[model samples]
Target: MAVSAGTVMPAAADTDPRGYLKIMKAQEMWKVADGTGITVAVIDSGVKLVPGLRSESVLPGVSFMEPPLEHPDQQYPPHDDFVGHGTTMTAAIVGDGSAGGPQGLAPGAKVMPIRTSIGTPMAFAAIGESAKGVRYAADNGAKIINLSIGGWWSLDKIRSAVEYAQSKGVLVFVAMGNEGDGNESANPIAALPGVFGVGAVDLTGEPLPSSSYGHATDLAAFGSKVQLRCTDNKGWCVADGGTSYATSLASASAALVWSAHPDWTANQVARVLIQTAGAPVDGSKRNDWVGYGVVRPRMVLLDRAGDPGAPDVDPLAAPAPAKTPTPSADQTSAAPRRAESAVAESGLSWQWPALGAVVAVSLGLGITVLVKRRRR
Candidate 1:
């Protein structure tokens, strides 16, 4: 519904220069106001209180490694980021669109950060840490949780955590890992039953050549050399080409739709993104690789007409019709507990991205999920 063309760094308030539209064009997303008051949890390296992000919007964040000030040397956890992947993803969701930056799809949405991995052993540890981080976010008030990283295993504890988060009415977004190199495996979060997995598409609206393929990738979005806000203060941040940025962007798009229609279930949100998405090559429909196709957040806003056919039923109200795997074998299995939220009283069936939404992430776990009455 909102549109703007930006030029140069530090562009005028009305003119956002970053081509991505959301991160650089702050006011643009605000005009439609689908994400006002919504909160997103960015489970990544860490958020450093960048410009235009609201202090009030920020909740207490955690990290496997201690804060930089506390651990000047290597004493802190090894999860401190060198790749800057998490920071770049954060800007795409909540950046103020400052100085020719890409405006996040939901600029008003606050971020809750959790830095779990930073490559190597610590990154491997993130496989376990992600379950903890997602659990924490759902326990709090995060409506949407974004995971731009992933790997190959699915642990029972992690499966339980995903189920718990969904029971609490949280929407999760995950990235299908990049396809380059020998790294070709099923991404974990994407493989999970409820998480929305994303893939990368270039500016030309084609799936990126580097995007890995798997059952986890449920949808695709712009990636490529697209730019967004950066912690580097350069006003032009290039997201590493892959589904990492795509997942983050999809999460922001979900924030926009959720903010506009808070009562809808997560399944409804997924249906909206799918039913409204624009097909670049063909008509609106699902493909093995692209799923329902590229997500068109604006369509969820109902600002446009005659795009994709709108679905009548909520896709996620009912659990997956198929059997979802659980990782009960691991001795380290400890699933996070979930507490019910306002969704139950509403009696609305919440939907989510189908199981195996784990394509774009960098880590994986093999685990089983079990259900039991949870106590608060």
Candidate 2:
């Protein structure tokens, strides 16, 4: 499932400005589980040890981006947050606000960074890189995998890798996309079975326009106007709010719950998050807009509402019905579209947009952030 290193490329940045800790009420949850002994694998661009992150909070991980063989005797560390996107994600999950910055939801949690690709608005030049990255993280002792970046591509290799991680009791959280449409084809990784597809919401718990919606959408978090420090020290930057930030936050929240109850399986943690999520508007039990609702990990930590279900059971699996339903016209016509989407995933017909004004432009930096993942 490993892809060649040549496929990784450059992309853009995004953000908003706000104190997410206060909004999510993370202080209350900290009293119970500060996420000690938990490891979150940030499978994005490489993560650097930024100003606020301590040496222990960030750990070295593998890189699918192959290094040049010419430097056979040289050592290359996969710790460079080249485009700063990965650094932003790591900060949101484990930052301690030591350098006058926003604190992470799980300050005591460690981040194991795996660089599968580089830059914003980038795609998996080799789609199998994502698959390999997932497997590598799980095998290396990561309980939760946070993918703040995604694309329309989905390889059989990637699906198998995700299934493998699930079997090992690891939770993988992926961004639901930012196209403002519920197009599963646009963000194929989120459609995989057993993965938790996360979307974005505002402080008031309203879904953002860029947050994609679909059956894959499992949970939502405050992604709009989130504030954190940048790798270059140009000051704190605000992510314009997309599913990328939300997915990272959701992953950190899971670490808190997991750290509190070391014996709970991934299924039990997932069940607790779903049961504790704040109810959304339209409230039809479940919908494509925001799935279960905004993640409320505090409810499980303080209220002790996270009842560990069957250790081996998956809560996301639909119950078996007495009979199979007949295929409707919509279902019949969807076959051709699915085929078309498969073609799109492998092709470069779709293009991403440039970074917005809010994302601080690096001086002399030649990166052109595109419209994929959660930034668009």
Give the TM-score of each candidate.
0.69, 0.76
Q: Where does candidate 1 stray beyond 4 Å?
A: 1-17, 22-29, 51-57, 65-82, 99-101, 180-185, 228-236, 280-284, 302-376
For every candidate, C-alpha RMSD to the true structure in Å: 12.3, 10.6
lDDT of each: 0.54, 0.62
In the range 102-168, model 1's lDDT, one tens digit per residue, is 4566777877887764432345456567788889889988888887766544466677887888888
Q: Which lDDT value does model 2 have at 175? A: 76
Off by over 4 Å in 2: 1-18, 67-76, 120-123, 181-186, 228-235, 319-376
Highest lDDT model number? 2
Lowest-sum lDDT 10-residue window in model 1:
342-351
Model 2: how large is the Cα RMSD against the reference? 10.6
Q: Taking the tens digit of each residue's C-alpha lDDT, what string does model 2 give over 65-153? A: 54435643544356875555666678778876655444688998999988754442234332456678889988999999987666534
